[model samples]
Target: MKILVVGGYGVGKTTLVGAISEIEPLTTEADVTEASTDQDRTAGTEAKATTTVALDFGRITLLRHGLQLLLFGAPGQPRFWFMWDDLATGALGAVVMADTRRLADCFPIVEYCERLRLPFVVAVNEFDGSFPYLAEEVRDALALTERVPIRTCDAREPASVQAVLITLAEHALALHRAQRPLTH
Candidate 1:
């Protein structure tokens, strides 16, 4: 399965990819300089010293189903959005990571997936402690339809990241089955 992992700046897209990947992930990360910060649209990412300049690539093999997943993570800054289309192309599905502190940052990614009719799951990256909102509350805030699944996880934890992937895989399968015509 080919999947794209995307989210806003400093939302843990790269961390999630690295935690669960069986192989050493390929990342085009660069030091965040003053110039780089100037280009960022949102605030509170000052603590982030490095940013994914191009993309992050990783691979994981699901032992249960013997399925191999190719994960591509997009750069979060708006300036790097040009790469999003290329990364998204031919992807079976996508996972949009969300940070409760800056919830609005995920809007673009959500809209992109919806516009392209790509199956996706919204994973709220719980930082340190849990957010005040429930999954339903986040769904309502993002205006996500019932078809989209909302999950909360700590991206730094391997098990949590793996669970998110599992959820995404199940969602993709259901989407595929629903789209196919019934056969005798």
Candidate 2:
């Protein structure tokens, strides 16, 4: 199944894909140049020297479930959002990576998923020196419904990324089942 990893610029969508992908992840990262200084906001991510200009592609197999997931990391800058519609085609669901330091940056991603009726889970990428907000706190901050799963994770850790992916897969499955009409 195809899944999206989307969030605001510098929120670690690429990092999460690279961490969990069994194969060598494909990334379209470009150096942060002065030309984009005014376009890309770097308030909490000043240390970031590169940004995903297109998308990051990765794949992982859930052996237990016999499912293979195709991950597509969307470019975060608003200027690149034009590619989002194409990337979202045939997507089963998405993981909306969140950064507590720039929590509001993720609002658009969340709204996009909601508008598409896409099942998604918010994975809070725990950055060093950033305040640790509980899952509930994040949901409240994002004004998300209780049904949406919100979990914390370290994008750099493969295990952490895997856990978030599992959460999204399960949530999507549950929603799919609920929507299917029953035949007696």
Q: Could you say which candidate leads in lDDT?
A: 2
Tens digits of per-residue lDDT for model 2 on 1-184?
9999999999999999999999999999999988887777778777889999999999999799888999999999999999999999999999999999999898898999999999999999989899999999999999999999998999999999989988998999999999999989
Which parts of model 1 are misplaced by more than 4 Å? none
Stretch of 10 with least lDDT, candidate 2 = 37-46
Assess candidate 2 and give its lDDT: 0.93
lDDT of each: 0.91, 0.93
After superposing candidate 2, which stretches have Cα over 4 Å from the reference? 64-66
Tens-place lDDT per residue, model 1, 3-118, is 99999999999999998899999999999888877778557667788999999999999788898999999998889999999999999999999998898998988999999999
State the RMSD for candidate 2.
Answer: 1.0
Best model per TM-score: 2
Query: How many residue-pair clashes does candidate 2 contain?
Result: 0
The RMSD of every model to the true structure, in order and in angstroms, is 1.3, 1.0
